[model samples]
Target chain A: MSGVSENRVLAGSPSTGEAARGGLIADVPRRALILLGLFAALLLVAPATVGDYLLSVMILVLYYAYLGLAWNVMMGFAGQFSLGHALYIGLGGYTAGALFVHYGLPPWFGMVVGAAVAAVMGGVIGALGFRFGVKGVYFALLTIAFAEFTRILFDHWGWVGASSGLYLPVEYRDTDDLWLLRGSATMFYYVILAMTAGAFILCHWLLQRRVGYYWQAIREDQEAAQTLGIDVFRYKMIAVMLSAAMTAIGGVFYAFYYNNLYPETIFSMHRSIELMLGVIIGGIGTLFGPILGAIVLTTLGEMLTGLTEDLGLDGIKQMSYGVALLVIIVYRPGGLWPWLRRRLGLEKPR
Target chain B: MPIDFLLNILVAGLLTGLVYGLMALGLSAIFGVMKVVNFAHGDMMVVAMYATYTLYTAAGLEPVAALPLVAAGLFVFGFALQRGLVNRFINATEHMQFLLLLGVAMVITNGTLMVFGPDARNVQLDYAFDSYNVGPLIVDKVRVIAAGVAGGTALLLAAFFRFTVTGKAIRACADNFTGAQVVGLHVNHLYAVTFGIGAACVGVAGTLLLLITDVHPHLSTDYTLLGFIIVILGGLGSLGGALLGGVLVGLSEALSGALIAPSLKSMFSFGLLILVLLLRPQGLLGKQA
Candidate 1:
């Protein structure tokens, strides 16, 4: 029962408080709704209250939360382990970035186009793997293979600037250009915040629906799900496609926010690892877990960076991060959200 | 362009493949026993390589002379890692196991970066520039010696598995986890020992690699994927398959680097992997799943 814990937890309380009943805000228990409402209000005013630097950090936190939420749809929900998620990020970013740079297409339109491309790529990979019944670690390797192949191809292709990297023309301004994704930090923060909140709601909605239940069933036992008349392949494909499409949206933001992209950095195994670290560290398959994880990890990571810089321990910085992660995983393999949920009174103490 | 030049490349590729096989041999052994692909396989090897490099530089000990000490040290490190950290995750989800090993790899890799300062270090032996004349082929002396040493180590590993009681116990555990446990085998201790042996094989391979390659922290990154590719290509748990897969991959690299662009060499390997995975997922010599 690798995922039985998640299934049990999600069944009792999918997102915030315990309630299998359907409907939005009204369906949530009084306490969770209040807490979520307060959290949302805080985020809405955060841009104005926080300094520019902290605002930027919050933007990153939201961005990572969005990425984690997107990734969780596939792995946490569907139990399909994709280790080469950077492939989708690269696909989304490059698709949008290339279209904008070369053809002068607006990023809003490019985002849609990027999502389609990413979905197609994810479909191809999922088909290759699922059709052959390549599950577990071997399936993970297949994802990496596709990602590495794409990276190599991009490195050699000069059309998208090749290994020299792709750069987007930026006109920094106070006024926001929503169409072009050109705006201030606050504007970007709101965009990512919207995406993260929307993704969380969408996941919660899905989890309580037929599709979500099917995904959980499939996750818990594929053979059992198949015997119970579930179209295992179709649901799995939906998970892959939906996750890929959402991840592409994050990639679109990454391209514009960073204003430059290198194939190596974009498709590197490092990107894939970091993208899932939030979900893994947070409660996998839980609604607020990715959000909590994104905040804790990004904040702590930033703190670690500053602390190391101040103490002249910069060299051992990553080593320290690695060691800390090990300790955390060893102590809380189920994730930090469950522990925090008890304190928050979201769930009864066992 | 010339035939002799082609022959030289072929010989060189085969020699390099032998070393690659040795590196993968260790990885395959670990997976054979534990069924957990040691994500830190390459970095653990890097630890041995760095130790070998230090021996050569600090005390003027030859890499060959210090091989035994370095291998033994890696064995202890691997055993301790399994017992202390990885053992907990043996029964955990695949994702947890992957994350745990990845954390270990990051620690080892970044720790090396911190200590080694990211400089690419190399060894300069007397015969570094020398090669042997074998008819139309001119093979590097260092490559030949390294290959011979690798082959010899592989044989020693075989004999260890075949003859030693501890080695036999480890093999039995791999064959049947519950069966071994039912027979009153110390499974945890045996698992640690298997991990240690895996690390030692990598230690042997890394020392030989230090003879031909420049040592660097980042070198560990490429080797992890490379080891996985070779291990998969050979056959999941088959030692002989790993060697054969290594040679094929090595030759592919050589041929592709010589004929096509060097950047595209990895592309060829991945392509071959996808093809094999589709056609025969069991690997070239792997038993039917």
Candidate 2:
């Protein structure tokens, strides 16, 4: 999406733009291959090199990156900003967790069910909102209201343990119960890494297709896209459903990894914001922006936590998030990707 | 429920509704002129609450007495906020405005948390607990007085918008940003003024709220969400609509809390919001989108 937009935006500088496009077209496959290689190498080598704590942090980074990618598919690619994406996460987590806990279904099956459930939920929201011509902030608010309603519903639904939260058994009997989702941090880390890599590849594939072009067109201008023979509504719905399904996978991972699901934490507005922060800071509408954003934010967050712990400041984490977002939005609204691309001389004309 | 009990609930709901209206008025006003939803509005209200709390705690002023000072303080804050941050993105996309205001909200809420240490603070007035019995209803003195102030302010705002030149200018901007610009309206100044007035409304609400509830950094989101509900229900930018919407929401909440579980009150309101969006997208009094 960013690629398409950047071409039009940077067209003002014909030379640089042309050069950048050329460079990008040449660089795309090579960059992808290199990134995959590096990721694989890191995946293989990191568990051995880093301590358990660091491994856990890496897992968190990957998890967030995956979620950010899912969110980016909707807001960045389709330009349908959903403020309550945590709805999908929560739905997925609860469904998978409940199945695992109550029905003795393995997370392997539960995860798929969770994803389907989230997709359906997303479909309902998108249908109701779009069918009624709700757009802009109204659409955003509707999403929020739905999320809040679900949160409240979950809060009272005792089957999910109500507000006390649904807890999954964390007793590790065997370290290699892959089907059951019982494993070491290393096992979970590897699984999450696969998922993150898969998500990135999926986004790349989608962005390369006709659907991706349609999404980008709709995002750039809905009316123009419709006039150009694009089914804006169907495309938007697909974007939402796909995004929700992907987010559900993350939620299932979270449920098993964290071994607990609370309506408050899972469905909180803060959770939605956290997922979006990565996409926003990294670069919306770009393939690797969410990954880059996840890394930077997680590293900064850890550093801030450590600094605050050392200084005995209780709420610096929240404060820092605000300051960072403000600085990014005000000074670098296009986010770090374009700037990073320029700095690295990777600004392709294609 | 018995008639008297229902009546009591109605009175209580109406009082709280008036407060909600005042809480939402500033946001409505700001949206009217700028068409931007100020996500930081709740945090601004928290700032007002803290300001009022400080006045009462440090200076021994009554919460009601501290109202003007808090209003003035918030007015300045809102003015500067619009001029410095919001003005830059005034013409930007709705998403940009949202992110900007969200950033502002985060800064204000977290900044307050850092400074105030997450402690809940409230001023204690002697008459806060005092109540008067009328027929079969009991009304707390603080709430009644707060309700009166809220009602009075709503009326004043209505008159201001109706008669005052500056208010009319703000209205003009709300009515048509481009047309107002063509007519030589100082859109920027009017935006700042509108935001200031909105902040002042929060100031008034904050003062009244502090009499009954504690001020905490975490509460800002709740206030912000509630304010959004009211604004949406009332129709964005309509003063009377805000009041009406607030009353309806407040009544719904109170009745639900009494008739159903206390936990479901918020859900009810949020559900109503979804219903409204689907059924009546323009809201009760809002112009057709």
Candidate 3:
């Protein structure tokens, strides 16, 4: 009944066998260094070369890239597909924003508190959901339900300002308030860039470790992985916890950077879908795919919006995105980054 | 609570449950026969609603009068979509197929949004607001009619599956695709016809829904979630399960809203889903995995 033999047949074939073989250490490290250098250079040069609109777009790209990486840790690497990822982001934003507004806590400390709260929430949901044998689409639905529940709860709760929304005091004059993270878009852009880099490195390190291998095995075949003595529940819970914590950080960044938090907007299914879109369009399991996806999607979105506005066509951007998604899935299911990597002779042939 | 209030809630809940059951029937039929979860099922319903709405507005016909045309139109639309597009990925992994359906849903939703913008529309039948007396209770005439229509459709569907050759072939294919193929069943045509039946069910449900509530482009998500929950609760591939599950959910929602708060209605349903999944992974009427 279990498709273990089918999996073996599919995985052991030579076409995929090459993919399973880890690259040479020299080539891997060299590629890693090149990517790192390129990123650092972009960070330093982007602010000067790009205008305000482009800078804001870059910020969004970086934010989404960070989110995509965070989500991939759970969904792609660990094979736990969560459709309610906005729960973490919403929780994180509300935590930090509420604390900053109510208690006068600095954004830095607020961010940590937010992340911790999100991780704990993730742990509880993951524990309950996994323990109850909710997997696959059921698990996805559960996550969505939880997120929606949270949104509704927050919508009526006035302590977090309810549906009217919460606004952080923006004192542009206090540009040097690094602790509170109140500054120009340029300053916040750098902060997000730094966070994105840190998250990327963290995910790369995690994926290279034993836990990563355990996750992949579990994802590919949970029953077989369990038969091999792997603690599937523990690894999955950890993946969720880590992913939630990381997503919370992104939420905190979103709150302070935007200086606004709306339950409907932040905790929306749309935000979750947007994050997943980055992962899907980039490449699910690949290390660099999320960032690539975020950049490409953000750029394409901007272009589409501009084109629609220029042509005086309403709702064309969304339609274009839908068409793009269809074309991408039908033609290049492996995602753009992996396809490009294969084509460029940078990675081993599929 | 007053006795009349309780009775009213109960009646309303039962009627809504019947309608939900009708909607779930399409999903259940498709799943039962094809083993594919059609995420776009709700969108098809939306399409039917739009078609019905257009007929009501343009032709000045009542929703009930437009039902047959809408159902037939949707049946053809669904048959073509499934035969032309979805069948290509029937052999793909379930996860990939889910994604594909999600993509299809997005395309449909966006296309509708582009066409209609973001406004709610309702089919205004003069008699929709009418009421009827049933013994000591007064009920909305439209709701009673919708429920009757839904039950009749279910009965007719049951008969079709029991008495018709193509319907039996569909059931046979659902039981085992490979065996059905080896036994000389036209698997492809059966699949398409099964989908067409499902779509027709949704079309009927959509027309029925327009009698009681407003329709909008975004209504698809709420209906999709509700249908999925009902189908899952009823078990994956059982028509009776869908019917029973829909009634249960509808009753719970109504009772919860009457007893607790209106905002907690969705939460109650979700809680029930989790509890049922935990206690009986196979669902109330589901076969053991």
Candidate 4:
């Protein structure tokens, strides 16, 4: 497998191994860390200078980055292509929102509950799908069916406001309530940043672990992974559960940060596609690819919307996105990040 | 309560199944010929529907009357798309190809959204509302014609595949691409031709559907999902499988709607899909994995 060869090269080189084995080592890419730190610092401080609209866009980028990373774990790493990841996100949002609305539970607690529910749901889907040996596009369709089913069911159920949507009561004083996750734009920015950071760390850690190696093996060739006694099913399930849990947290962040939850909006297939667009256009199965993709795509989307508003070329956003996807698939199927990595001499040829 | 009601449901189920079968035919053909699940099948149907609608509204022609032109146009379109766009990713991994198709589907759908807008349009025919009473059961004339058209198309497709040289070549290519290539078959042309046929089937289905229902840009998602379910249920590349699966799904939907709530209709089909996947895995009529 390609990843196996890449892994051997990365781990086999003693100098690189020593650098990667420890934090802040001399062999580590100091420029990359410095750039990342600089970016983080800018992100943290930008809300002060940026307007509400820009902050909103930033929030979307962070959200997409977070969701993309979560999705990448199952899809890019574990080779499970799920089309219904919005199921976890929607479930997470709804669970937390419903708990808050009905039981008046604090959002921090509700978030945990939401993540747990998503994890369980992921487990069920994983067990049923993997146990029955539903592979490839069939498994993807299965996930879509389940997600759509849940969406329809939730759309019908009125307790959490159903299709009408659930709105978080806007209390002026509640903005200061960190427990409820209610805050101003700056606070929300920091919160989403922290969440994005957490997701990135989790993904990085997982990618560096033994389980990551197993996942790569399974992804590259399931039969080979099985022959190597990698317990494909278990690892796949673990990836699903972890991915779901992370996505559920994103859902919670969405609900609280946005202060609204709509079945159609949260659980829509469009949302799933949006989540995938970032990863696909950036680079699937690569660390930080989703983040870069999210940033680029979101920025482009915002720019397109702005252009439409200014120049009045309606529907250009969708057209541009279509064109972008086509161009990427045709010219650089591995996506912009991988292409950039090669161009910049960051990625060595096999 | 009455026999007529049951008969009406049965008739409705059969007609619906025919439409489903037509939709699945294209998907099945693409899958069989190229081993590619054309997720854009539904979008192609949507595009055909839009074309039919445009012809109907602007040219003042009946959708059924416009079927041939629309089918021919879409045949060209599908051929061009497959040859120009899809052929590039044929050598890529299955996952990449799937994503590529998905991206293409997205482009088609969003492009439709841009051109047609999100408003729903119906191909208004004078005969749409005209129905006949067969004893106690009321049968819509349009639906009956649609069923007949669908069945005829399916039969014609079956015959074409069985008898035509290009069709045989397509089948050979599908069965073994490398072997067929070695045997002097033009695999690329065959693929484009198969995709064109698939798109043509969707065109026919779209025109017929316009006779009974409305068309929307987003309706492709539902059709895609339904076609996917039927294809899976029928076995991926089997025409007979698609037909049987479509009928089964249509009947199940009808019965479930009759026995349960209308809202739970899709849930029933989904549940059946899960059960089938668990038990058979190869689908009811699919070849062994």
Best by lDDT: 2
TM-score of chain B of each: 0.97, 0.97, 0.97, 0.96
Instruction: Give TM per candidate.
Output: 0.96, 0.95, 0.93, 0.95
Using Cα atoms, each model's DockQ against the true complex is 0.59, 0.63, 0.38, 0.49
Candidate 3 docking band: acceptable
**Candidate 2: segments with Cα more than 4 A from true spot:** A1-36
Candidate 2 docking DockQ = 0.63
Q: List the residue pairs that clash in candidate 1.
A: none
Q: Judged by TM-score, which candidate is best?
A: 1
Per-chain TM-score, chain A, candidate 4:
0.91
| B1-289: candidate 3 lDDT, tens digit per residue | 7898889888988998998999999998988888788888888888888888888888898888888998898889879978987787787766566666777777777677777767899977778779988876789999999999999999999999999998889889988889999999889988999889999999999999888888888878678878888988999788989989888888999998889878779777877766666667677898987
> Tens digits of per-residue lDDT for model 2 on A1-350?
12225422211232333334454333354554575578679777899899988999999999999999999999988989899999999999999999999999999898899999999999999999889988988898899998999999999999999999999997846557888989798899889999998998787666655687788889888999999999899999999999999999999999999999999889988899889988888888887788888998888888899877866666677677777788877888877766876676544445
Model 4: per-residue Cα lDDT over B1-289, one tens digit each? 6777888988888888898888898999998888888888888899988999999889998877898998999899889989998887777666667777777887788778878878889876777789989888888999899889999999999999999998889999988988999999989999999999999999999888888788887887788888888888888889988888888888888877887777779877777776776677677788998
The CA lDDT of each predicted structure is 0.85, 0.86, 0.82, 0.82
At residue A151, give the lDDT of candidate 4: 82
Give the residue spans of candidate 1 off by over 4 A: A1-22, A310-317, A348-350
For model 4, the superposed segments whose C-alpha errors exceed 4 Å read: A1-21, A24-27, A310-315, A342-350
Local accuracy of candidate 1 as per-residue lDDT tens digits, B1-289: 9988888888898999998998899889888988888989989888888999999999999988998998899999989989998888788877678778988988899888878877899888987879888788888888888889888888888899899998899899999999999999999999999888889889988998888889888778678888988988988888898888889998999999888998899999988887777778888999999
Over A1-350, each residue of candidate 4 has an lDDT whose tens digit, in order, gives: 13112222112123443434664233324455666688889988898898999999999999999999999989888889899999999989998988998889987888899999999999999999999888888888888888888887887888988788998877776356678777787788888899998888777666655787788788878999999988888999999999998899999988888788888778877788789888878877877778989998899988988877865545566566667777776776666776665565554323
Relative to the unseen true structure, what is the C-alpha lDDT of residue A226 in candidate 3, on a scale of 0 to 100?
A: 97
Candidates sorted by DockQ, best first: 2, 1, 4, 3
TM-score of 2: 0.95
Interface RMSD of each: 2.2, 2.9, 4.1, 3.0
